[model samples]
Target: MGDLVYFLNGRKAEKIEAVTFADLRMQESDIEEILRSSIDMICDDEESMLIVGQQVKNEKNGRSDLTAIDNNGNIVLIEIKRDRKDIEGRKEAFEFQAIRYAASYATLESTEDLVKKVYAPYIEKYRSEFELGVLTSYELLIRKLNEFLRVNKAGKSFNKKQKIVLVASDFDEQTLSAVSWLNSNHVDMSCYKLTPFKVNDEIYLQTEKVLPVTNYEDYYVNLMDKSLATIVKRNKGGTRRTLPKIDSMLDWGVVKEGDVIAVKDRDNEGILLANGNIMVNDKEKSMQSWLKEIYGWSSVQTYVFAIHKESGKSLSQIREEYMTQQAMEASDDF
Candidate 1:
């Protein structure tokens, strides 16, 4: 059956009948409006989520349905599709469109800049309609944006991650398979089905996350982590390394060819390395892998201070000196 059947009180005379978006005269735009106002219906934490932009134009002249940023600074792109009987190839079209938007959004560098441009306009458009007192929506948006930015700056890195969400009345088998494959590979995509029903004058809506089902969410996350770790390890083998530069300031001045260096942490040192190879705790890992293991995210620059057993100076100090020298050399080139 295309509709979900409901019975009242186990065997009551009342019945809840299935309703389509058309029956309610609700368009995709109406659904978008409702979602913009109540995003938490889809995202778990409403307080930490902000609908920054809607109908946002991308670099390729395509407009995205909604753009939001979570407290973690991860950008979320949402696309809405109406699955009507008249529509054909809706699955492929909607999925492909959302993926394209995601690809374009992944290039965004500064979350602050995006907030100022896209979110500012959205707040301005809806400010007068909000009943939340004298504080304009724009002002509140900025306050939330600043708070998120501050917290993210002090904590683990953000703004580099992007997730795509597709909302529709129903998903086809092909679309489900595509989303499943993407989520399995750590692409961070999800599909939510918004089914509508009616019982007399009351209209009820049901939301279900079709992709990466709740029962398997933990398993999926763990699998993705392992897969990422494996990829990092494989890439480490191909990375080029430079000879260890010796500093003469310390008593044990030089870094020996086989000395082990550790990434500092309270419980887990992550990985110990000697001569560009994993020596302890791990089989093959690089600085990037170590950072991912310790911080649960990948950063271009390593945050931990690597220390050599012989030298008193921390790796941070050595890196600072090296950077300073490189800056001086670059000035000469100019």
Candidate 2:
């Protein structure tokens, strides 16, 4: 069993007593309630994520624990299993259910579709519990969704990218191996073990990511990138386009030799230095490497905005104008 024991400071190490949920009379519903109320406690990026729906129904007539959208526009499906023993007989069942929900969610075409289909039901179901005279639940939800898109500049379609989070008190070897393999292949899957411990009168919850391991996260991310690159290459006649060199960007006046540029899309972002080296989420990379790392395909273009260290223009504004100019030039060429 997963647990934590308190230690007393002394000349000799003394093992303080520790207790489990059974001793405290805590139930599965308690964990679920805590998670549902404050999901950020478990999500990887709380600032960029919005929990838009709960107990969402899948096409299979089953309910998903929670559904969220991140700033990158990736759909996040979270499933919670109260304790290690609770998943004994139904280990595969939870995985299958999460997969079904992901499959269904992958069909969503746009954020609007998500708001209308997934979030609307949640708003309506809980409308009465919210405060009035301010924004209505529906309006508040839309504002939150739009704000996320505006801040992230994530344009709609999250169907292609999905993240599945499986939370349980403990995961057996079988489930851990399965999720680890899936994460390495192409699925962005994570398993979190939430263990509860009690000492005296206080209860402490410990959450650990048991799958993929924290140190190996980048390795799995690279593997998934390679897999996606392969898929993109295969789908596009097995040819990968070369990204434009830094000189071209400089000549086009999009970026100067010493300027820092942020290349972004609805789901990801990469930073390019004036010296031609690129960085995605702080990891140094080359242009082609960053493109492949971010979008899986070089031909898949995204918004590139020059960051002016001394200017008042926002990155989003810069990106918007750049896109507008590109659209106009494309129209003229057409």
Candidate achieving the largest TM-score: 2
lDDT at position 137, candidate 2: 60
lDDT of 2 by residue, 51-122 (tens): 677888877687888888765778889888766576776746666668888989988887678988898887
- What TM-score, over all chains together, does every model reach? 0.57, 0.59
Give the C-alpha lDDT of model 1: 0.60
Highest lDDT scorer: 2
> Which residue pairs of candidate 1 clash?
none
What C-alpha lDDT values do all the predictions have?
A: 0.60, 0.61
Alpha carbon lDDT at 92, candidate 2? 60
Stretches > 4 Å off in candidate 1: 1-13, 45-47, 84-87, 90-92, 129-140, 149-156, 214-334
Once model 1 is optimally superposed onto the true structure by TM-score, how far is the C-alpha of residue 182 displaced, in angstroms? 0.9
List model 1 lDDT by residue over 1-334, tens digit each: 1546575776775656567887789998999998886665575311245577889887778899988876567778989877635234444466678889888877766655776667778767766643446665556665656655554452244567888888887765546556666776788787777888887688788776555543322223343244532322233221112213233222233444456565543244433333343344546665444543443222312322355444545555665566678789999999
